[model samples]
Target: MSFPAELSAAAQAVEARLAAAIQALPDSRVRAAMAHGIHGGKGLRGYLVLESAALHDVPREAALNAAAAIEAMHAYSLVHDDLPAMDDDDLRRGRPTAHIAFDEATAILAGDALQALAFELCAQPEQPQAAALTLKLAQAAGAAGMVLGQALDIAAETAATPLSLQQITALQNGKTGALFNWACTAGPLMADADPAPLAAYAKALGLAFQITDDILDTEGNAETAGKRLQKDAEAGKATFVSLLGLEAARARAQDLITEACDALAPYGKKAESLRSAARFVISRDK
Candidate 1:
């Protein structure tokens, strides 16, 4: 299958796994909100997990679990990120935000539950690499990783001066790059192989992904983006496009994509899917 087709297949498998797990929970408003939170995403991170697993010859079942875990974690982040205290947006994936779909309290609980579920999936007894994956996941999603980036972002909003380009880049490394790091390294981690190559690739891919997001926010239609656009500009926040002109930002993203693909050299032709994924990151409109 081609890259997009493979990505879609991976997404479908991961979503199914997520839905089944959520379905097993007792019916409640929180459960409903959790379901809503995980629905309708691109599942890019999950695809990366599966792809990396394939590259390392990890078992399909274990890869699916890992993929589902990351997707759940990502969904939880988005759910909370849309809260009134955070980014304060409504639309997500062209639908109402979880807080709007349910209530603020339910959304918060749902996010918490989803986060817990992520670890649960990672630590399942059947997986041989469960312990290592769980430990790394905690580190990646905790204060040292995604949360740290978020805290930095919130701090930047009230700082005396705008964040410098370097500062924002550091913030994004945690906020966005951490999970990408985990996803890309998962296969190697599961297979007990060196993860350096994929980790390097993920670093570049994550930065490119965020730069493209900044570009989209600057020039994309809100409808096409499935969320608010120009939010950074409206809030007077600095971004890649704000720091670098549009042409420059686009060029930078392309350069990062190239770097990401170059990092895949160890796998040679076997990594074309990843190369395509790197290209897709910069080309996507939403």
Candidate 2:
């Protein structure tokens, strides 16, 4: 299957920006570790930032900083999530995870430093909307968003009953959807334009992404996934595939992808890359 050239270009641009941003950090083992964590990925969130910014005619100077910042933040999340206390993974991106490559202390510090750098980059945007952008990022990654979702996930393990569908949706809306929302609407937000359409797109795309993740967990191999798979089942976790069954979950993801594309109807041809991204969410192997 042919992937869209536009998305590939956007991903490359974001990857370069992320690398440059990390290279500018002050020299230290932690800095090196931070760079290591940021290296290599599909770079979907950062690509969304750049593409959305382009749609709104936001300059590269402003968009690059925001794009790099989001990737930095995402890298931090993965580093921490792979810790012994969290997802407890030893592999990521087909290599040893941060904690495994470096010591636990170094990995912890890498995550902390990368997270700080994310805000620093956001603060330096050429546009005057730096403050607003930073605020949204904080809200998305903080206790009100991704952290809240993770906390809910951890707590759910101890609950006597499994989380309901509604409960899971609410949790994932923060954990996964919030970043997508920020990425998809970043250009509009920076330009002080309406974000309703992109927000609607992200809501559907993010859910589809998570549902596919659940499906992958059930049927994917760790080698292709670059990390453990089927662990959700091993942990007896509630997931879309577990709740809705395999075919149902796949159908639901397809429906959501269609919905996400529909949300971009106003943008027409300008949103074709974003539409491709929505499809990629479900089709990715890792």
Candidate 3:
């Protein structure tokens, strides 16, 4: 299948599963908001889960629930990230953000509920590796991972000086790379196979992904980006683009994409779509 097709397939599967899960919750404004939160985006994290699982010959059914789990967590993060106390954004996916569309209180509740549901899906996987998967999910989403990254980002805004390259790298690893790592490695974890190669791949891919995001923020159309852009520059925040210049940042992202593909050596041709996905990361408009 073409890379776009595969991504669509992954997104479709994950969305269906997520919809079903949200439908099971008791009806309320928060439940509606939860549905709203999971409504859109590229579904790259969920795609990673499905593709990695396919590489390991893990059954899709076994991994589909896990795929949905990560997407739910990602959605929750975005919802909270758009809150007034966070990025203070009023738009997401080219629409009113969760907090703006729903009441702030409802958005908060929806985010909280989505987060809880992510753990539930991971922990209740029909596969035998439920405990390990659950632990990994918590580690990625908890303070030591994504939350830690978000905290550092918030702190960076108030620091006397802008974040250095190394500091920003660390922050991106937590804020963005953590989930990418989990997504890329979940297949191997499910198969009880070694996750080292995928881990390496994800490390490079995550950084490249963030670097491209930095690039997009610099020159992307806000309408195309479906959210605010250039906020970093507006806030005087340091980014890969700010530190390295656009040409150098783009070069660095290309280098990392190559690194990401190289790390998939063990899977040989089986990883073609994954490689394509890496390439797509830098090329995406939004």
lDDT of each: 0.93, 0.87, 0.93
> Which is the better candidate, 1 or 2, if ranked by TM-score?
1
lDDT of 3 by residue, 1-286 (tens): 7777778877988999998999999889999999999987799999999989999998878788989999999999999999999999998999999989989999999999999999989888376499999899999999999999999999988889999999999999999999999999999999999999999999999999999999999999999989999899988899999999999999999999999999999999999989999999999889
lDDT (C-alpha) at residue 253 in model 3:
100
Which pairs, if any, clash in model 1?
Answer: none
lDDT of 2 by residue, 1-286 (tens): 2555666676677778777877776788888888789877678898888878989999888898888888888899999989999889998988899999998999999999888988998898365488999999999999999889888988877778878888889989988988888888899999999999999999999999999989888998889888888887888878888889899999999999999999999999998888888998999877
Which segments of model 2 are wrong by more than 4 Å? 1-5
Return the TM-score for candidate 1, rounded to 2 decimals: 0.98
Estimate TM-scores for all models.
Answer: 0.98, 0.96, 0.98
Candidate 2's TM-score: 0.96
lDDT-better candidate, 2 vs 3: 3
